[model samples]
Target: MELLKVSGVNKAFGGLKALNDVNLTVNEGTVHAIIGPNGAGKSTLLNCFVGRLIPDTGTVMFADKSLIGLKAHQINQAGVSRVFQTPEIFGELSLLQNVMIPTMAKRDGEFALHAFKRLDKDAEIIDTALHSLEDVGLADKKDVIANSLSRGDKRRLELAMCLVQSPRLLLLDEPTAGMSRADTNNTIDLLKRIGEDHNITKVVIEHDMHVVFSLATTVSVLAQGTVICEGKPQDIKGDPRVQEAYLGGAHL
Candidate 1:
């Protein structure tokens, strides 16, 4: 039931080796979190998964299908969606309209803005958007401009955008990076609800231990471009290698 796998992955920039001989496997329908210090190559491994970076020698597989040579749009079309560190949304559009855009995207990377459907069909699209909005707790603000939303709401809007695609695997990079405690906890609840409601597999790169422990079913700890340890929440907490990874460095 492994949904994604990375084996023998290596990445470097000039003289700096970001990832070295790394291997990982993510099971279906679980939140797998990758955590490490600032320079542990956590993001480097994420890029390998999403086609943003190709490793020097490795296999990146989603459902056993290779992803190394695919383009970003191609990766997205393959049912892998990513939520960036920042909220990526249209500031000028209403929340509903913003959600409508991705639902209108064709698999070939073109936006079918003018492919007007029948009235009933368009109405169905609207209903879909509304339901997605409700899923993210934004149904009441469907008509509000995206920019007017608070920081947490903006993040929720981004989640709604991704959900509209019905992605089988969702990758999140620091989903709670810049939120207050209440917002962060709320986002955790939202993600938990999302997992239960949608049955989506999630791969998250996170620095917040609270968020990681709250949502992750499995945790991988990386240090100096290699995974030093990996285990369940309780196991990772008491791991001496995990302790060493953060003892002399910055928090993760």
Candidate 2:
């Protein structure tokens, strides 16, 4: 049950090749992690899946449908949701209001400021948004302004926003970045619980080995715009190529 597949994908920026013959498969309801050093094309590859960049050649399929040329919103409509490294939230809005926007977008197919005018009258959507906030432990602070939240809380809010969309696949780019160790561990627990509760497939691009080993059932290592090593966590840790990629052969 491959939920997402990338085969022979290639992307280049002028003289620099970002992704070269990259291929990846994410199974349904499992966490697949992509790891690499800086400039290794991890983010570039993610952008391709979400239509931010179209690969120069190859196929990207989601449940057998091609995702190469679809717009970002269209790809999102096809049940793919992305949470960026920086939390993408409506800073001026309340946390609940922030989550509500995506709920409306999921139902109405487009998001507009005018949609919030009708938000109060839509009890079902409000309830759904609240539930999403609760899942991420932000229900109590639902009224807090998004910009006022701490870094960790902002990330949780972003996850809630994505959850309201009921996406079948979630793409997370450095989900626990810029967090304290405590917050990072809490995020790992939250993600594991979300997997148990929602049964959503996740593809994560992360620099944190702890988060990766804790959540990823499968791992892919990219280097110099190519997938150099891929396997289970235990297998990947000992792979010489992965060790070299990260630490110049000193050991991961």
Clashes of 1: 0
Instruction: Record all residue pairs in model 1 with backbone atoms less than 3 Å apart, i.e. clashing.
Output: none
- What stretches of model 1 exceed 4 Å from their correct place? 106-121, 249-252
Clashes of each: 0, 0
**What are the per-residue Cα lDDT tens digits for candidate 1 across 1-252?**
999998889999999999999989899998999999888999889998888898999899898899999988888888898898988899999999998877766232554445465633677678888899999989999989999998889999999989888898999999999898998999999999999999999999999999999999999998988888888988999998898888866554
Candidate 2 lDDT at 64 equals 98
The TM-score of candidate 1 is 0.93
On a 0 to 1 TM-score scale, where does candidate 2 land against the true structure?
Answer: 0.95
Q: What is the lDDT of candidate 1?
A: 0.89
**Model 2 pairs whose backbones collide:** none
Candidate number of the best lDDT: 2
